[model samples]
Target: MKKRTVADRGADGSERPRHCADGMPNTTMEVHVMHKSIRTPHADTRRRAAGGELIGSQEANGTHAWRGIRYAQAPTGPLRWRAPQPASAWDGVFHALAHGPMAPQYAGLLAPVPAKLYGRIVGDEDCLSLNIFAPAWASDAVPAGVQRRPVMVWIHGGGNAVGTAASYDAARNYAAHDGMVVVTVNYRLGVLGWFRHPALHEADSGTAEERSGNFGTLDLIAALRWVRDNIAAFGGDPGCVTIFGESAGGQNVLTLLASPLAAGLFQRAIAQSPVAETFSVHEATERNDLPLESQRTSAREVVARLWTAAGKAPDVDAADQALHATPATDLATWLRSLKPEELLSVFKPGSVGICLSPRPVRDGVVLPLDPLPEVFRHGAWNRVPVIIGSNRDEYRTFLADKPEHVRLLFGKLPLLRDRAEYITESNFYSQAWRSLHVEEPADAMLAGGHADVWTYRFDWDEAPAVPFVRPDILLGAAHGMEMAFAFRDTAGELDIFGINTSSNRAGRRAVAQAMGDAWTSFARVGVPRLSGDAQWQRRTHGMAAETLLIDSPAGGGLRMAGVRQDIASLKASLRLSPQVSSGESRCRIYARVFLWSPLFAGLGSEQEYAELGREFGCAQPASVFRQLTEV
Candidate 1:
């Protein structure tokens, strides 16, 4: 190792010991410089792991963090769609200072790029890695009768298409103050992570996991296995692991719960703003001849696009014929040889930054054939303690981008056109999200005889007032708003909307403390406990089901109520609300809520929309609104 002397200059230009080459302060120089001031020196941040020796960095918060620790081999060359393999042991010390590359994806808000490279692919195919953060004393010798710290593994959310482990700073708060080991992981995204085709399966020699096309799911499972085998070196209890995430990460949390292969990998789980939806084998592979942009995610459609782009076929018909005539081995080789950017260019991203790709597939191997709800209802899932929730205004953040509701000024600031209509529509869709993500899943787990389920609704919507821009109206308790509080992220890691302000800092800090306490408490034990009299209760059956409301003190604070919603009740309330002006407006809201939302997308059809309109005194057919919205 290269040796260097580093010091801090005092106000008088005198040298002060700050860091040494061995990762410890120069105690002799410090004692002579300041005779009265002294402190215990921190241990060197070097540790041994199964893979090799790792050297991490110490943070300002007195925590040790290791980034870009390879848990699995890079999925490149012929291993593109195969299950992840464990990383081979190395010979020398690995300096884990920076994060590994994210999965290949288009540059967006989650993974931003330079202005010149906007909308371009900006990641790598060799992206399977994990990060770890622990307290400074984690590597020290444990005293007698003391137990290891609980582990919390984080999975980032980017529609399961775009995100990186480096985007978050886990050691700043969660690990430094909460006395727990935190882990952030990166898995394959978009088509590379979850593609299903017969040719690729033939290349892999017919392995069940490879044929399932759930490579991302398998990547997460491999990470958990690595934690179980190696987390003890970081002073973590592998048996007390908790899997948590928001948005698509939350969706993956639910997927792991229902996966038989993920059994015993974790003892607790927290899913925030999660959508419980999965694609079937047919939806993942079969060609959908629909004109909508979403139908192009299927493997058959992707192959046709690649074929035409590669000049191997003239049109769709010729592409289909060539695909049929090509040998399975040749097709697999051609797919492996294509550049990552070329494969990513075939699919377009939605306004919300999510690519049109199938999520977790129900392939009957890694995941069950039945839907997640059915699997939980039948007690076929890994029954662990769970906390599930959604935001109150889940759809406002999404709807703010729609041209009809809000118009952008200077291509940045937002101006709401109709506050009443925007709020009404946001309510309908947000309630639907809550019902599907929280209520139904909680009810299913209860039915499966697992009563250790807690639920919450994030309702903190106190954005400071700004002229011309109404963040309070545009982003009121919207999706992913609770993550900053959940992780105690005072540095604004998850605050992409710039909702934080000086006026709300105190309230935000209070809420963050309460939430961080509750989460750490849950990881320590199975139940969640707060500091004050606000005791979070479990979900019960029947009409008396209760949900904890998480909010700031200025916004009614944290409380519990017996509030529940379902599709039937939501439609009924929409029909009665005075804000719904006309049949056309009501149909527009219905189209967005039922057809575009991930929870009900594939299940809802035009026939159901028309039937709903007729039953509620609206004479407009569903096609009229569908054509207008192009949904």
Candidate 2:
């Protein structure tokens, strides 16, 4: 037997710590922990890339989970606004048991939940962690001929500002039952994660990928690197990794496709209703509704304004000048020095009409000047088998929001006076329901010889309505509704759709089964097939866009909606819609729903909103026009 020799003890008999392969020092001692969540007798031993061993808990259902594992070091203090660094090595066995802390965010960001059943939570800066779930079939090792399951890395969506790795618990998903592995990740959020300043740019001596700003994106890249290096231990194919995210997470997935820094980290990708908007860094940094360009907001301007308003500085202008003159290193130090609360006050949610958080920058280094155009037109992005889709009723979640603004501008429409109304598929005055969301971007990805781009439209709207004003209108497979069905995550089951008797239980179950299988199958072989044997086809031609409409209400089978037929249907719907004004304005009630899609954009044009207003006959109040002029 080869005897393991350690360095001799010091004069005082203190043992020397062993060094990790990653150069992080650690004590050469193993830890034994019986994770409480482990219901099974057998625990899996997984080794981390940084030389830490993990005792993963086995589920009663024959699955295994390694929760709250830090993919990167705690991004705090000096590391606050910088890219994520490597996680340090630990001497004892790191118990991948409890979920990690989430990035700091405002409360109530989650889909409405039953507080009694699922407790409300806060966040912390020490939150760059991830959770891995593998099927019971995926033991520590597989035979030479046996294939390792594909890894699906989940990035939760809360507008790149909120949400955590622990937000959705899908222990019952296909990944846990089928031959696959799932990983949910947490990255920095809000001002802490995406903030960038001209001053912080001073010390950027590293490569373009090391550029500051968009630290949240950087954290994601870092997590992907960690997964690529370490997911094998969990019985995953490091090479065959797919990143799937919804909403903001979907946007991140698309961004990753465009990011040179994130190249080769992932293979296949799925983006669910990504917030598709790309603008220049200046366009992002500037204020939306403000009058003066000089008063446009950025981290520097906000810090200066907040400091001056708080009486720390002599005045606002002087503070701005001082901040501009501040050294780059000192600028980062000073920004980190300010109270998190104070910094957040500068750009709180709903401060403006929009959720204008610090957007991902188009810094010449990390992100190109224009990503989508370059990718689709110039062909400069990481091409992979991609699935991009959106719900049938996406704007329903924010229906009341836009309508509320309209109500505030022009006195409430008599039709929707009392109701917190939004656009819907209801046949209001012969107008049929239509949606253009998430389709335009999908069309942009139909480049030949690039990737097999499969498009989908989730049209089931049988979700249980919660406290939302109108369950009928607000709960139609709205934005982010598919996540629960995709991961089979029922954490917010009760509050999200009131699972008791309101929701279609059997339908939800069926949809969940189909979607889960589709996702897993896609990860397995880059194609999504339904249980009923209908294949999801790709859109090859520009106008011949074909999508697999994943719907249960219309029928429990795949309904292929070809773009050619869809265009004809849209024209028919528009022709049926009234073009002239009627009593109390029919356009006000239906324009947002039927005319608000890119598919229907040519029909609506830039004058659609005005045309709708004209048809309503109830011209927008003079006050509303005045308000617009003032702005």
Candidate 3:
């Protein structure tokens, strides 16, 4: 196969050449090009780092960006399903212009493509690369008495299934305005990233790390190792590195906290809208038999599906028998021989190309055998300065897409079908998300003796109230809304729905500035100091724990609030809340909170659901609960 170079094409797969407007090779050491006009430049875009000699580009923000720098070799062919290996040093200048291919996944919002390719499988297996954004002075000679800037590594979220580093421009505001070094990484996703079966393990002679069924987690550790070794070349302090991510990325942040291999790799951690859930080795490898186990796609299920599809068996039972009879080595080779698309086809796709697959396995090697909250409670995790938070209306973004709750006007804009139902469901699920992802973890960390833990609740929901769209009700402080504020994304890179309108720009900018300052301040020092008299406090134990409420000035601005509710309290309140009009409605909410949401797996039981229903004088039938359980 031919080698890929940055000059070959753009991320959209269009062929483009790297050159200056003067029709000459743009190989100057330190040339600044502003609005297509060259100007005086003091820093060299070229750097000799641990990876190799490479040439980056000077961005409009006065930040230098090095794109598509390989941190690990391609996890393809024989290297598939194995721990990442470091990339070998190259000989000549590498054109770090465009981003490398993302991990193979169905096209969606996380990895957007043209409409014609919306749900099609895109990207490649050779996708273990990272992008760097540093202040202009980073690549230049160090000043006489200046200290190295703090490093912040960002991990994108796509359910650990579909996301790319290229979608984000780290230099836009974080690296440029905050005076910090930023790095974004791409790792394997979906089944390719996390899968475990006895056959593959029997065929391999590798160590525990390779057989952990947590290849994506290992990829992140590899990226951190690369940062530790090479970040200093970009004038960043490796010792002050911070890892921050949202959603699935946030879950990864929590996973790293529990991972013994990740100890000392980072000094500070931030997990935004993270799910504090990790699967057991049995959950990752076998089919779900118990009611507590999540109905996620498992290794055995995938093999059976593939077997039936290939005419090797007529049904899942037959497929399982055939798979059991086959030799382990032969099974391993057959699995590796399948194409990426063929392997991905076995699982059903969600509304936007999301595949509900198992990931971040608790293999007892990379991660502790206990659950993340339990790990924290036992004081066994990497106890670092941590900042954890969640959006106030996280579930609205997800529920807005469901036809039962919302309907699209002209098949484009969203209109809530039942306002009361929508609000009630959104409130319950959103708070449930916070309980699992934010509150429980914070409380557990405090129990585990980690004192420097700051918590926040993003309450900014100033989206414009345009015609045919009820932004306030539909997407008020929804999941991922806080990301733009954190990154100060004035370019609207994340505003896919046009939420950041002209009318809301001022309020958005204000919130963004506040959030950006707090984030960078946390990265610099352990404490997150806000502007003026408003102080962000660390979370303490019990009900009086303080939480910083992040919002626009019109929405109360940034201030400290008391502790929030947990899952048990939320459940108890729901049973008494006037919003639940009927037993069926209450049962539906219970099913979604306990069964449908992956974060709440093993936290609910059928008996509990039945008991809750009995409180309403009409318990839902067993069939109704069973159908929801399967979902």
What TM-score would every model get versus the actual structure?
0.90, 0.77, 0.90
Per-candidate Cα lDDT values, in order, are 0.78, 0.60, 0.79
- 1 or 2, which is superior by lDDT? 1
Q: Candidate 1: which pairs clash? A: none
Kindly give the stretch of ten consecutive residues in candidate 3 with the minimal lDDT sum.
18-27
| Candidate 3 lDDT over residue span 479-501, tens digit each | 88898889877567667556878
Q: What is the lDDT of residue 84 in candidate 2?
A: 87
User: Could you give me the TM-score of model 3 versus the true structure?
Assistant: 0.90
Separately for all candidates shown, the number of backbone clashes (residues 3 or more apart, or on different chains) is 0, 2, 0
Error of 2 at 457 (Å): 1.3
Question: Residue 492, candidate 2: how far off, in angstroms?
Answer: 7.0
Q: Please give the ranking of all candidate structures by lDDT, highest first, separated by commas.
A: 3, 1, 2
